[model samples]
Target: MNEPFVRSGNRHRPLSEARARAARFAGALQDLGIGHGDRYAIVMRNEISYLEANLGAAAIGAVPVPVNWHWTGTDLEHLLTDSGSKVAVVHSDLIPAVEAHMPPGMRIVEAGVPAEIREVYGLGDVPLTGRHPVMDDLIDQTEPAVATDQAPPLAVIYTSGTTGLAKGILRDPVRPEAVPGMMRSLSDLFGLQPGYTTVLPAPLYHSAPNINMISAAALGMNIIIMPRFDAEEFLRLVDRYHVDSVQMVPTMFVRMLRLPKEVRDKYDVSSLKSVVHAAAPCPPDVKRAMIDWFGPIVKEYYGGSEGGAWVQCTTEEWLAHPGTVGKPAGGAAIRILGPDRQELPVGETGVIYGRPADYWPDFTYLNDDAKRREIDGGDGFITVGDVGRVDEDGYLYLSDRLNDMVISGGVNIYPAEIEACLLRLEGVKDAAVFGIPDPEMGESLAAHVELVPGAKVTADDVRGHVQRSLARYKVPKVVVFEERLPREDTGKLFKRRLKEKYRPAEGNA
Candidate 1:
């Protein structure tokens, strides 16, 4: 177990104490009649208890399923239902989300122990306190936390649902043994040392830092947890804590660079060793700026929660290949396959597949076996449905998602959802929305449309229709009138041609 891990905001948790709390929590879970192998959903923002819940669940052999903190009731309700998770350990602030669509028979347990979590589910007379039901006194509280080497389902993270409703990436970790394997490539690439202090600005609810926490803790590194990322405060924390490593979405790096020059130089950043960028694509310009400012310290990783996160491109490597995800990960194999599942020749864009002999945790999609078929090539090879090409040097370059999902301002937006809404408008005939690049926003959505014959419609009308149907981020910024959308020989709209036609933010039309 990890010893010297620190949490963000007010609480500082010592791992040994965290281990004790896990034992108590485990006992409390048993009092609720939760048995080994049962799934417990931990739906709280980043905090000390995330560590506790994970450890406590591990202590008792119960599974811990972390809910994505950003997901609303509409989004979260489906995940909890799909995972079959009852007995939610939730944060007081997020009681509303839990209130909306909690499983009918599921029990609600507050997460943080010292404080009374604020939600009331009306099923309680007196809140259940500590393990052992109603014992005023407790024994074995000081019992050494014993961990088994059993490979059990540790946690389940949903697939973000950028393309559709989220599905589970059910994980089975064997006594933190799988931790080192994932960290090995990253550690070796960045030269991470045991004494290195790492600042985790990303949410721990996600896979990147969830695994990073286990890896850093086992290696005896000081893991600094942030409640959420704030660009200015992140720099301040790094300066104060002598932070050596940081991992974030490429957008975070862009936002940090946006800060005033005076603010950027206010802190001493010499302790920074490497910054890992994930979650979305990094524009070539942004990557180059980071390299120029920090000397090739910005590292880019291209992977997904569905097992293959091996494709990586460092800032310096991008300078050479100019946009290529550096050579395949050691012992990890990638093949770019065409639509027919045939291997594509070099310079041909296709779906990238990977099969790593080890370091791949047993990732299975919960409940829906059909969804599982999409990612797995069977016999260990998996693809996350990303489209990309391979250069002569074995480096990979992602073109887009074959499904035409639009990513705007670093957040993913689905065209099918937007198009479905646009079709509802009275004057609309046909519609398609896609992303185009911008320096500020990594990309922006542009909707191309064909109006019903002689029916007048403006961009604002179409934009208004989309905003009402979906989240504000999904709305298109520009709308273009098209006589007809250009199509390939197969009658499919050629998205590459569409993107090339409608560039970012308009250069004076």
Candidate 2:
């Protein structure tokens, strides 16, 4: 029986069909001179073909590089050249944007955008320009690749490049023997098991969601893919399909929580067994509200693409330790280090450095080993530049990104603390806080806020609200209201963009 399937919008394909297409695509890649450990880029929105292309490449031990669709210009060129991708499977509509950036000798395969995505994005149907081979046609013309026992190499996941240029993460291929242990750890981290049904609303380009898709397929779980995240539509899919598990980020939680009570209560979500979240720091209030709404099924994990999930907490554990992301798990080791690289006392905020469970393989930045060495904390631990500390009970609390810390007038400030406070206000919809140049103090705080529609919230109101709970210096000196703050679809705040606005003149700084 074809018990497991992958559904996107109105289209559903049995896993068997998907596997067959993947084998054909793998054969096509090999025919194009792609070899084991070679790379191919996938540049499309969430769709069935994306899955086929990714799986096809991995089937023959080739690495798939999932490029963020939002990327253009140098960011796009850099990733294509950096990954050394021999072929790029791009969406038909997105061809124009990427055509100019294609590196010399790289092949292009166009995949048509599905109706569900076209309707939502209001994208008009564009016939293929025929400048490159089509993915479906290639699959039809090629033969199925031979099966193999060797484990597939992981995708080359690039960092968000918030501080600088994007760097691709290259990991050692998993050994077939280690597959069992790694699968167990993944199942634990995601709270998923085989034969379950799961929904994925997050972008496949992100590391966690990408890994989730691969793992769910491996475990024979039915997968439902959303073209894009819509708070109400998400509920409808879960209720309609009786989805057993789902993964999300903090922003999604905020959007769902903000929905009217009547709209939220319209759909039955009792079928959900596990709801996991990570990728950004979630406010305590937001998390608590989700737990209250979704029952004790809400869970969270803490880690990065570099290490996978090293720490996680359940609903009960989070309730016991408010604001904690949870203690280390999966045989992981963690530390809070000060500027001197000395271990800090309990509850002292500092740079967080750690390694995930041994089941995960070590990785380095592609083409840049020196940068990887920079993050290596002695004794095999790697720091991802996050700032946090552990409590007396060993539960970790995230402060903010280490690069985002503001040193103003000789006092250290963590913007995440203030941003969380801003979100608690009635009218505030979103907020971003960062340091700006101040001639007298070296740096000063600036707060950019997005308010609920029709809500009358002034700059003073924002500062006053923050002052009530935080120190005087923590309050923003400059407050600006924005219709919407710059944020990634994955829910990570793009503070680097905000910082660029206040960047000092090249000669002045």
Q: State each model's CA lDDT, in order.
A: 0.69, 0.89
- Residue 151 in model 2: lDDT: 67
Tell me model 1's lDDT, rounded to 2 decimals: 0.69
lDDT tens digits, residues 282-339, model 1? Answer: 6666677777766768777776776646677777687889877666675677888876
Largest TM-score belongs to which candidate?
2
Which residue runs of candidate 1 sit more than 4 Å off their true CA positions? 1-3, 112-146, 172-183, 189-192, 405-445, 448-509
| Predicted candidate 2 versus true structure: per-residue lDDT over 1-509, tens digit per residue | 34899999999999879989999999999988787889999999997887888888667889999999998998899999999999999999888878889799998888988898897788878678788898899999999988666666799999888877799999988877777888998887776788888998999999999899989988989999888999999999989988889889989998998789999999999998899999988888889899889899998989889988878899999999989888898888889998898989999989999877777888999999999998888887889999999999999999899889999999999998999899889898889999999999999999999999999999899989999989999999999998889788887877888889898788987
TM-score of each: 0.73, 0.98
- In candidate 2, position 506 carries an lDDT of 88
Model 1 worst lDDT run, 10 consecutive residues: 131-140
Highest lDDT model number:
2
